[model samples]
Target: MPAPEGFAYVVRGADVVISHHGRPVTTLRGRRAAAFLDDVEREDPQELMARLTGNYRRGNERQARNHPRNRGR
Candidate 1:
């Protein structure tokens, strides 16, 4: 399918993808996806850090509840 207006089509190996307003229109894979990620990295560092930190915090909370320190309380 053709990408919507204002969106750019990115071909990664054999797949086609699009991105807009700094977010990808859909999850893409392969070399093109990798390149897209690189572009995102170069464009936005704060948003990436926020996502990573949020994920880490969520996982840490799950792990903390299973730890011995909180096992009985």
Candidate 2:
């Protein structure tokens, strides 16, 4: 959904960087790197980071469970 406001990223070498308002928000890598990027582009920032980085935010629990795609298969 046009990415979250101020949310943008780039996959460089092996790292997937998530940024907001030109500031670095977080970096994701490993086998699920691409998956994380998809999350960044699709899910809300709160839900995406919560699921990928374990950084939770209030009121986002529901968003996490109802994420766009909940399966890794």
Candidate 3:
């Protein structure tokens, strides 16, 4: 799948607020917030935010599509 887009983050005090397409999605606090800030600088920020917000691909679509229950579709 293509990389996600429209993800942005802002640090607020000890928290990190994540947004997608201008809408708030999730917040990271304390250690998680610290780690995210560090990683975002070195990795693809959009993908990272998508992951943090549980919006990234899980690589299971093909499997799901091939499952017996879904095969008829």
Pick by lDDT: which candidate is best? Answer: 3
Q: 7-66, model 2: which lDDT tens digit per residue?
A: 566788888876666778778788677777666577675556545544444566667777
Model 3, total clashes: 0
Candidate 2 versus truth, CA RMSD in Å, comes to 10.9
Candidate 1 lDDT at 5 equals 34
For residues 1-73, could you state the per-residue lDDT of candidate 1 as single tens digits? 2222344445666554554555565545677466656766585533443332232134467688899999997
How much lDDT does each candidate structure score? 0.52, 0.63, 0.92
Q: Mark the 10 consecutive residues where model 1 has the least summed lDDT.
A: 49-58
- lDDT of model 2, residue 51: 50
Which has the greatest TM-score?
Answer: 3
- Residue-pair clashes per candidate, as listed? 1, 0, 0
How far residue 46's Cα lies from its native spot in candidate 1, in Å, is 28
Rate residue 41 of model 2 by lDDT.
70
Where is the poorest 10-residue window by lDDT in model 2?
A: 1-10
Task: Name every residue pair that clashes in candidate 2.
Answer: none
* Sort order, lDDT high to low: 3, 2, 1
Deviating ranges (above 4 Å) for candidate 2: 1-3, 38-73
Q: Candidate 3: minimum summed lDDT over ten consecutive residues — where?
A: 1-10
Using lDDT as the measure, name the better of candidate 1 and candidate 3. 3
